[model samples]
Target: MNASSDGSTTLFVLLGRIADRTLDDATRREAVLVEATLRDSIRAKALDVPDIAQAARAARERGVTVHLLDDGGLGPYETAVADEIRGAIVGHLRCATSGSITVRILPAGRPTLAAVVVQSGDHTERYEFPAPTGEQAHTLFHGLRRGVGRSHS
Candidate 1:
């Protein structure tokens, strides 16, 4: 999507306009998708996406957040982890119930897909990684599961 230093600022501006008191619900959804695409581009870095586990650790101290645009492109492992992530942030935000959690699947030259869930307010909390196999993947899954979770044990 980075064809020219990348992404149109207009899309970002439109996200702000989602609050226009006159816009119908349908229009607002479109505006959010546009906004998410650009916001993901800006946040993903495209070249060097951060490791999701480490980022999740940091996010655990803050909060987890995403609006899923997965579209079934993510592999099984990513899909499972993404499911966990989707579960983690449910009902956690007061932003628009629909577009509050913005998850952008970014393609990097790395081995695994990156999923960054963002809820922009006073700050943005996001994390993603190329989910590898074995113990590492298990750890990644757990981190995402707990990114916004409070353990009862």
Candidate 2:
């Protein structure tokens, strides 16, 4: 999460709950197959892309402050953890999004799969973007990692 100069905070939150479940040989293989199928569906547009816009609409109706950040040119792997580790994150402008994803791997002749669940919320989402130099980016990376370590505890 990052706070804007205007004193509102925009947080990007990821919530995941991992579970332990026992599956027999056949069942475990099936799970992997299913994940690959779903991934293909989304990629082919057989499944609709994610609908973040709907959440924005609901926030507007309820009179809750909402800010959307669309930082382009950054790949998913990088952007996924970028803002969360930035120095500018602060305040009640806490915006949060939660989700779960499952990935399974099976033996030969079987399949591998993954599933994800997502939820997003905001008290008052304050989006922020400050051009950080290379040194600043390095600092942000370490800071974010430190924050993540604390949360796990």
Candidate 3:
């Protein structure tokens, strides 16, 4: 992370929650509350990581460009937001799985703030898909599709 002459800290949190899966509900709710507190703390400067997805959305709405980094799958937490954030303030959204560890690099900006929302419940689990074989229906689709196939017993 790099600091500017101005007094603003670059904050980045790694969010790793998989899509369409239930996470620690308690933790998620706590995140909302923590996010509010964080906003208050960083009112004088820059802060990051109060709520995972919501914080980014808020930042974007406030003319702060939001850059999201996700593989669309579960992955490890790595500090990569520094390259994208150029504004006076920087923030991050990070999530972790059972065996993964999150890491962040502290830059020269003073009063760097970070908050974590941890829930006590079942973590997200990965799913697998079976490859299609033989002749299957083929068509040109222009929109989203949701399909659930049943397995033979």
Candidate lDDT values, in order: 0.44, 0.27, 0.27
Q: Which 10 consecutive residues of model 3 have the lowest summed lDDT?
A: 136-145
Compute the lDDT of residue 90 as modeled in candidate 1: 34
Clashes (N, CA, C under 3 Å) per candidate: 7, 3, 9
- The candidate that wins on TM-score is 1
**Model 3: per-residue Cα lDDT over 15-41, one tens digit each:** 333233444775465345434434534
Candidate 1 residue-wise lDDT, 7-102, digit = tens: 356455565665556567766665654554444445543211223322322333243333334433344554566566444433232222332345
Ranking by lDDT: 1, 2, 3
Model 3: CA > 4 A from native? 1-32, 35-45, 49-95, 98-105, 109-153
Q: Which parts of model 1 have CA positions greater than 4 angstroms off?
A: 1-67, 71-73, 78-82, 89-100, 107-112, 117-119, 146-153
What clash pairs does model 3 have?
Answer: 13-92, 13-93, 14-93, 14-94, 14-95, 15-93, 15-94, 15-95, 16-95
TM-score of 2: 0.23
Give the alpha carbon lDDT tens digit for every residue of 3-77 in model 2: 122111111110111124445674454444333333323332211112222332233334433333222222222
In angstroms, the error of model 2 at 31 is 32
In model 2, where do residues sit more than 4 Å from their true spots? 1-62, 65-73, 76-127, 140-153
Best candidate (score: lDDT): 1
